[model samples]
Target: MNKVTKQNALRAHSWAGVFLSVLLFLVCLSGTIAVFHFEFERWEQPHIQEMESVTPATIEKAMDTFLTQNPQESHHLFVVFPTSDIPRLVVENDHSAYFADQEGNLIEKESVSFTEMLVDLHLYLNLPHSWGMILVSALGAILCTLIITGIVAHKRISRDAFKFRRGGNGQQSQIDLHNRFGLWASPFHMVIAITGVYFGLAMVVMAVVAQVNYGGDRQAVMDQIFTPDPILAPQVGKPEIGKAFAQMQTLAPEKTPLFLTVHEVGAPEQFIEIYAKAPNRMIYAESYRFDTQGNYVGVAGYEFGEWGKQLAWSVYRLHFGDFAGMTSKWLYFVLGIMMTMLCVSGMEIWLSKKGHPVLATRLWYSVVWGSVSALALTAITDMFYSGSLTVVFWCLMVVNTALTVAMKGLSKSVWLMISGISVLGLLVFYLIVHTTASVTIASLQLNIPMAVYVCWSLYRANTLLKRERMAPSAKAQSGSPAQQTPA
Candidate 1:
């Protein structure tokens, strides 16, 4: 409220933004794109047969076929049913996965490596899950810090709400845009931050909870939070999956069965668990349990459980905007882009104030645009090469930064141009590769928008280049360094 307090808040806000700028940008960008991960998965293998529904017998046959082919013991087996969003049946185990046809035949081994890479990057920063998640989640907490401090720092927040001042080293414009974005999106920002923290810190919280309440038994804590596994006897043949499917119709007629999991496969405690989505509800799924003989056991109670349990269950959908179908997904996508731009603009404000140091600016440009380029490169690689996408991604990132800093007089716009060209090239290459096959609706849905983005990026790059070219002339006439600086 006071001048000194506001100054301190401003300092903290700037410091935190600079501290986590790149990581924050990386996470935000990946997460924004990761909103379409399901589409990406569908695009990855558009040739697969997609069906609206598969019969219970078909699922049974597919399971039998999978088991017969792979005799190796598996801890768990999963059969993901078709939905309006992702209309493909996927049968997988802990070790392998395959797409299944209407006739119950296993098709190609499922390959959505690129989409997985993108999602993993967003979720774990491509680091080992144990540690990367903690670091990413810490960024979320810092985001909250930045948000609060930024709000406090803005003394004339109400009057400045709609203000925009261009020119003069572009610092004023950057500040105004950053402040406006932060202010307007504060609610969304807070939700993302809190949910983001919960994902990774959840493990730590559970561990502490287990220590305090369950004698350090994490499973006990889990059992308390989630539905406990149903008890079953040793005698069993193949699980009565068809019968279980039939029983679900009567058990939870209002819910839609999303997937079925066979827990402790081939073991004494093996049972069928069906995860069904409840209509007009946010909980991820309410799981229904059945014995090997397909006798209905009970439900997971997520829909009718304690408030905490329901809240915990709903976090994924709420965080990812997966609840209301494509409309919600698109809304999240737009807001996510705003969030990603917030990260970039936050750093831009700091960089403008710091006079945009050459090395820092170039490195930052490499990170910002290079990430875009590398994602395209990796996706191109995934089309023909089945290698470590994470390695390719990071290696390209390092190379981009090296080249950007190494090349003299290279403007940041060039990197943007490169990013646009690379994405366009990826699109062209994909079309060429799949020229023989008919492009599915899934591919068209993503590719068309991607083309539009490429055009926009290229246009932006040209505009920036023109501005940079005129900067010197503008400086000569105005005799002001601030006037000559490009935004």
Candidate 2:
């Protein structure tokens, strides 16, 4: 009965992996890339003057300048302060965002962020907010299911801890690689899955709870989980940004203000909020509240909040492995690759079991490799075209699929080879685009990853081609008796 249960668990795990293959891959890959979100921002807008700290007067000046341009529309205001990765100040409103120099001079308008768009894919699969998040959370649930069942099925996990085979046939090689990564990094994967599920389902859960207890007062429910968004009203006096900073120094001197947000400009109910990050806190940043006159309100309690609240708020950092900075992000990036390959290999095993249907295999390769090719190519084109990258990416994927369909009787490996070639081409294109541009730390941050991935893509493509070339020879050497089949 125990053995049977284990077999059932294995079956369930494999089936779940098959069911969630593509989405899981998309989420994991985007998340891996998004580890460099701040760096991407720097790369996106390098023209802005960067500094360690911008004065409160400078922030106020930038805010005033922007608001003056649009007097009729009082959009919610956001100020993104300089960080280690993004060493510049940015102000965002409803319509668009622009960089502010150290002396509060409004710099050029910021461009659309492809890196952030990629992050959105991980967050919501680039779907509409509510539905996308719910669906992504569902993927997280499925991941947890896979993890539990996988452990059950691999009951001899400890015994097989050191078991890894390098050169073998496809399934055996894949199994070995999968088990090694899965078992070794199981804890980290579990944390990622749980936190991912938390973020994915958090809003839904809040809405449901709001419906049940608060009579569908969504705002009330939100107030319980988060500090409420400030109310807007007509006002006379301006907010003192410098005063607020002075108070925050006394409140959280150990922390650095990451961003400052003014909820409603020129309104009686207007408020200023600063997101400050302390040295070793897991929560992204704690909100420090202030009135328009810069009089300090209390902290949002995230930094020294209740344990449950603190844990709840730490989900984003835990999910993306951002807490430990670059080192942890690198670890996550590698694990993310492993996780994506795990998805592909898991599907590969399932398809091999199902007689390796040519149709399914081809479509799988098209979606996985083709999407990667699209992302790279989109970055390349973004330098030249002012079109929407989201649209551009999906269009590229559709084109890739069409190419797959058009090429009759070709192996799926061709798509991978093409993807590798496309990636290499993109690297060249990126170099060409930035050749004459001023080099910054952000450029290194972006280009180094591209170089690494080009090599990764090349390795994958070569491996696929080598396997394709050896397939017929492998079949011929299998020692099957062609003549004895007559008997």
Candidate 3:
């Protein structure tokens, strides 16, 4: 590439990273944690009974108990049976989830808001529905642009593959770290970006498809690719969930049942969809539909269907890294952190090339470190308190950002230390709790990783604090400010 072309590519890369870096950081970090969303849910309420297996009859009894207690007719009820990952029978309605043992005895009603909060943050940054998805998808596209631009602009990227420098030049060290992490994890990052766009922009795609192919009948388009609603019939009898489960086992014994959803309860159109996880399949699950009489209707085409149907069903597993279980989760978590680092260091590169305004640097610190602190605050609060957890999280983030900005002279290292301590504090809190089977395992899962992270944070914080210059200066250059400024 020519000199001018290389410089323009660099500017484009910088522009992409600087504009959406913070939002990308937020999404990536939350998504990393959301990889263990089910475990987090288990941690939130661990005392709920967990068992390896439950009889079909036991499931029916639990559903009956729930219906008898509620009295009011519910539109639907979902029963999520025990699995290796989440070893609990969870019965839920629109409002709340109820836990039950293998013997059909009710344990308690609890909410897993911490996991929900992380999901919301990752999925939409908690924006309103339509705007949130659209914007996040747009950011995904920008990330793709950055990926291409970054590769194009890095003239000696291959030569500097394993370079590491951390001496007098802060920008060089940041760039090295950024490049090392980014280059190693580039494929994973690309996978995440493409899959993320598919999920985030699905509704928009669906709308366009509806207009072009389905005469603007969105439901018709959806039904073609997805499961259609069951035909309405006269209300005859209550669904025998146990019978359905028995028949399902006979139908697909190779698959492990995950969830059973009863639709339109007490209505003529009522039916059941039993979700079963197929072994060694990329598709998340295959839905086994059943009629009101507990007779098996058929399996949803996701398991044995055309290419389009199978591909559509695979989206959830592919995007969330749930395809291969624990190994996939760990891979997703590590790559996710690398993506967050890329966002941060990409912005730092721009700052080093141009100028790092004190306000911009402080706000950057507030965004990065303050978010770390808020996550711990909300997780600890969710464990202890019973109010609205999302509100608590948003408020804590605002307060942390305010404090970071107000303390103008405080170094970013101080914020890092504070967040590190907060994380350790959260670990201590988790330690003091009454640990059950699920809690014990969940605690171990998070605490071990968190310990390593806290150590890294402490080391980074100390190193930064020891620096001669608190804020880095722009490098001496031959170019003018106009060339230095990103497009």
Top TM-score: which candidate number? 1
lDDT of 2 by residue, 1-487 (tens): 3999999999999878887788898887787778777777776654457798877788888878977764656546788888775778888776778888888888888885687677788889989987898898889889889888888898687788888766655677778778877788778778888888898788778889989999999889777668666444444477777688767668888887888887766666788889988788888889988877787776777777778778888887888887787898889888887777778778887888788887788888888878888888887778798877778887887887787778754455666666777777876776676664436666767767677777776787778778878988878866568633564
Off by over 4 Å in 2: 211-218, 228-235, 408-413, 473-487
Q: How accurate is candidate 1 locally (lDDT)?
A: 0.89
Rank list by lDDT: 1, 3, 2
- lDDT of all predictions, in order shown? 0.89, 0.78, 0.82
lDDT of 3 by residue, 64-138 (tens): 888777666578889998887798897776656788887897788867888888898888888886789778888
The best-first sequence of candidates by TM-score reads 1, 3, 2
Query: Over the stretch 1-487, how does candidate 1's per-residue lDDT look in tens digits?
Result: 8899999999998888888899999999999999889999998887888999889899989988988887788999999999877899888899999899999999989999999999999999999999999999999999899889989999898899999999777788887888898899889888888999999999899999999988899999898778788766773778888889888778988988899998988788899999999999999999999888888888878999999999999999988999999999998898898899988988877777788888888888888888999999999999889899999999999898778778966568988999999999999988988774437887888888889989999999999999999989876878776667687
RMSD of each: 3.0, 2.9, 5.5
